[model samples]
Target: MKAAPAAQQELLRLQALDTRLAQLAHRLNALPQTAPLAELATRDDAVRRSRAEAVGVLEDAKTELGRIESDVRIVEARIARDGERLTQTSSLKDVQALEGELVSLKRRLSDLEDQELVVMEKVEGAEGAVAAIDDERAAIAVAQQSLEAERDEASAGIATEREQTDRDRAVVAATIPADLLAFYEQRRVRGGGVGAALLRQRTCGGCTITLTGSDLEAVRRAAPDDVVQCPECDRILVRTDESGI
Candidate 1:
């Protein structure tokens, strides 16, 4: 004997629910761990900060180096002028003072050159730090790409499954009587998309409310193919083999 349209509609709703549940479960299972993405983001931020710091250091060192080099050049020029003045000076005191000034300028130039060397070394160290940070960022990018690919693959499978389920739903819906479909849709809108439910153990599957003995007897007396609604939630109730009642 063919089941009533109400029972068929309930079966469709169950299938739809199961499909939705399965899709959700698949997505939940496929999701990446939050910790790994968070950790990667942290590393990326740190690398960016380090690179910025390195650039600042390098710029400062270069500026200092330039300043020191300029000072050295100025001292050398002053020494040359003093040397020419000493050779031309006939006065004894002026010659001695000029010689002292030249010696001081030479010593200052040497100190400036040493400072420039120190600045250059710091600049090199800063550049190396920048390079290291860049490499780390590159590695992080590769890992991110791999993770994205995995997520896409997992999502694709779920999409395919959902498409197949939708096709099956369409097929099942086409066989349903229009009047029954309209009734189911109306009830479903009010009952959270569950218009019909199975009768399990004398309880309403829609509300899980147990039926009284009299109500149970009444349901039992109904035609086998008749569509009946639950007294509580008004959802069409279908009897199944698993119905404890």
Candidate 2:
């Protein structure tokens, strides 16, 4: 293949742009925020689960407290009815039985009140736990949002750079002959994004292999306009003054 020396040099510039573009793409995919965002997601899920459990416990405590209060009300009503009977009764035995029932009702009320207190304490503790979890979740949310913003900013910068690189690549590619450009594109796809390299110090820069004897002679004998290919990697070898023919 034959291309002007200027065009050959353009290939080097194209390769550099392509390499930078690849690096930018890699950086975009491996954004620093990705790992932390994933970790936050896991933590958020755990916190939510904990909050839900606390809510369940609190609700149960409330229900138990309500039942205890209801029972206490019933016992108080019974004591009031028995006390009225004692005031109305003429028989001594009936009065004694009513007094004994009143005492029992008082004991039952005390027990229900004690249970209510315990349940109320549990409810309070559960509420506190939920509040704490909510606070933690809110903090995590703020961190996640900040990280997302940073990731977006980094992505926007990379996108702007890529747009400029694309424009430069288009201009450089257009200056080369159509056939040569097409050949370079084909090699770039096949050679893992590298199509050309400098032949410096008798070494194939593409594959870092030193050419000797006949291989060296062939490259040295080639015209300046001739497109030499690396014998090891088959990439176009763009020769320059430092080529060490």
Candidate 3:
């Protein structure tokens, strides 16, 4: 392929713009807050799970408390009926039986009330646990929002730079001949974004391999307008005065 020396030099400028754009893309992806935001998401999920478990425990405790209260009500009703019967009965034996049942019913009510208190305590503890988890989730949400904002700000700055770089790349690319540009684009894809490299001293800048013997001799023989490729990496060689042919 043949391209003017000046055009070849423009290729390097185009490469610079492309490299800058790539760097900006990388910076956008690796914003400082991205990792922390990921961590915050994980923490938020855990807090949500804990809250769900705490709520389950709270509901169970409430149910148990309800059952105990119902049992106490039934026992109290039995005690009242038995006491009334003891007062109105004519037979002493009947009164004795009613009195004995009243005593048992009162004791059973006391036990039920005690059980209700323990369950109520459990409900309070479960509620506290849920509240703590909610607080943690809210904190995580705030942190995630902050990190996302920071990341978006950084990305916007990078996007601005990339836009300018794109304009610059278009200008430089327009200066390159169509066939030569196509050739460079192909090589750039193969070389991981480097299509052309400056040959400094005796080294192939693209692959950092020094040209020796026949490789160096061939480059020396090429015309000034000729587009020469690096033997090792196949990148177009853009020679300058500092190339040390």
Structural similarity to truth (TM-score) of each candidate = 0.64, 0.69, 0.78
Error of 3 at 157 (Å): 1.7
Against the unseen true structure, what C-alpha lDDT does each candidate score?
0.77, 0.91, 0.87
Candidate 1's C-alpha runs over 4 A off are: 1-11, 14-18, 21-29, 32-38, 84-94, 163-197, 201-245
RMSD of 2: 4.2
lDDT of 2 by residue, 93-140 (tens): 998999899899889889888888888899899889889999999999
Q: Which ten residues in a row have the lowest lDDT in candidate 1?
A: 1-10
RMSD of 3: 3.2
What 10-residue stretch in candidate 2 is worst by lDDT?
A: 60-69
lDDT assessment of candidate 1: 0.77
Query: For residues 1-245, what per-residue lDDT tens digits would candidate 3 score against the true structure?
Result: 78889999888898788778878888877888978888888878888888888899999988888888888888888888888888889998998888888888888888888888888899899889888888888888888888888888888878888888898889889988999999999999999989989899978778999999999999999999999999999999899987888
Best by TM-score: 3
Best candidate, lDDT-wise?
2
